[model samples]
Target: MMAPNNHFATLGLSIGADENQIKKAYRTLAKKWHPDKNHEAGAKEKFQEIAASYEYLSSKDRREMLERELRKPAAPAPPKAPQSTPQT
Candidate 1:
């Protein structure tokens, strides 16, 4: 089979993204590349490719697996302290 579209690579998602991530990524990209909004030559085509990827990854079984993966709790972020102001 041919290599997947570049947009999928850029989004860091497989042909196997979850429905939620697919929808989220699609909306994010569509907003960025909508024809009237983007001047790039292939903006529309890029948007369509994102949509297609979302469709492929949003199937019932795949979506469930994705959801399970998403549900795994993320590691807690590192704690931060307020920066002290330097004396003038």
Candidate 2:
């Protein structure tokens, strides 16, 4: 599942999406969800989320930081400590 705060997922785009793709997706979603256009229960909230996502991903530095974060490997789990047996 996509995280609630994931901007790429919010815009229905991939992490590797280019500027054009991001702009296109943002426009599409913004149009679809814009509170003025859609009267659905969550339209306003969704539109706001989309706008924030677009703003965040549109920045070159922020986008690069997110890409780097997504590309990073998961940290390895720490080794478990050996359990000692009770001495009689």
Candidate 3:
């Protein structure tokens, strides 16, 4: 799954955007990329992605989940093993 930030980026919004901002961005993007209005290549796919992002961000529960995820500290990276030298 794409990171939460990517969803916000898809709609040209920051993670801090409010519901009204999300709706406005979705409306603008939907009108611009709606397949019926835009015959250009990839319009349908773009519209789909925009719609999905809007839906994901619109739900209060999902938004709360996202906030919780953001609050958690990032997991530590796995330690790298020592490199072995090849014998000639």
Candidate 4:
């Protein structure tokens, strides 16, 4: 199966979007796609996806944690010592 898009894409926002921007986008989309509010065939499903994305991105700590994890440097592998050849 194909993988789903990231939370940012689901909300139509960039990964670096601020909390305010995220909230604004989510509110706008949620209002537009809400099942009761829209009554469209796929509106309910779309709203659920949006809600899940918003819930995940809404947490400042989680966002920061993901950012830090992405930004952290990877450790280098240790060098191997030279091997000496012995007479057979």
Candidate 5:
């Protein structure tokens, strides 16, 4: 099952992403994952998820309402440090 916050995950974006970033990511992914263009086995499902994520993020007025109701952004992840091989 998809997680509750799967939309942001699908777009490879932080949950607090501003609308422009959301739109930009949507356009980039949509072009890449469009089912007819992309023949990967899961491309249709991926495209659907991307379209829905974009729709959810595109609703500016609705987001304002949701933000007022929730009063908090989703947790922002800390940056990851580069991984290094351990001495063996």
Candidate 6:
């Protein structure tokens, strides 16, 4: 079974991806996995999921939410250790 967040995972992108990225990823995945192209039983479902994900992300409200989520500050990186002195 696909996960609740399968759309994000399938597209290999963050939830807040812009319309252009969403369209690009959808086109790529749709072409690769479309039921018309693939004979697999689940190909249709996969394509539908990708389409739905694109549609939702394309919506203005959802897009804003996604952008807000992505805009959170990233955790600070750990400090690097000091380098040892070089010998002459």
Best by lDDT: 2
Q: Write the per-residue lDDT of candidate 4 for residues 1-88, one digit (tens) a residue.
A: 3333468878887666889999999999999999889987999999999999889888988776655654556566689999999979
lDDT per residue as tens, model 2, 25-80:
99999999999999999999999999999999999898988888877776777999
Candidate 1 residue 52 Cα shift, in angstroms, is: 1.0
Each model's Cα RMSD: 9.9, 3.9, 2.7, 7.4, 9.1, 7.1
Q: Which stretches in model 3 have alpha-carbon errors above 4 Å?
A: 1-5, 86-88
Question: Where does candidate 3 clash, by residue pair?
Answer: none
TM-score for each of the candidates: 0.50, 0.79, 0.77, 0.66, 0.64, 0.62
In candidate 5, which residue pairs clash?
A: none
What does candidate 5's lDDT look like per residue over 1-88, in tens digits? Answer: 2225446667888656789888899999999999989999999998999999789768887655544544455566788999999998
**Model 1, clash count?**
0
| 41: Cα error in model 2, Å | 0.7
- Can you tell me which runs of candidate 1 are displaced by over 4 Å? 1-10, 14-16, 61-88
lDDT of 1 by residue, 1-88 (tens): 3333433444556645555766787788879988889989999887777667566565777555655555566667789988999999
TM-score of 3: 0.77
Tens digits of per-residue lDDT for model 6 on 2-86?
2244355567687666678878998999898898899898899888888888777768887676566556666677999999999
C-alpha-based local distance difference test score of model 6: 0.75
Poorest 10 consecutive residues by lDDT, candidate 2: 1-10
Better of 3 and 5 by TM-score: 3
Candidate 6, residue 70: Cα displacement in angstroms equals 7.7
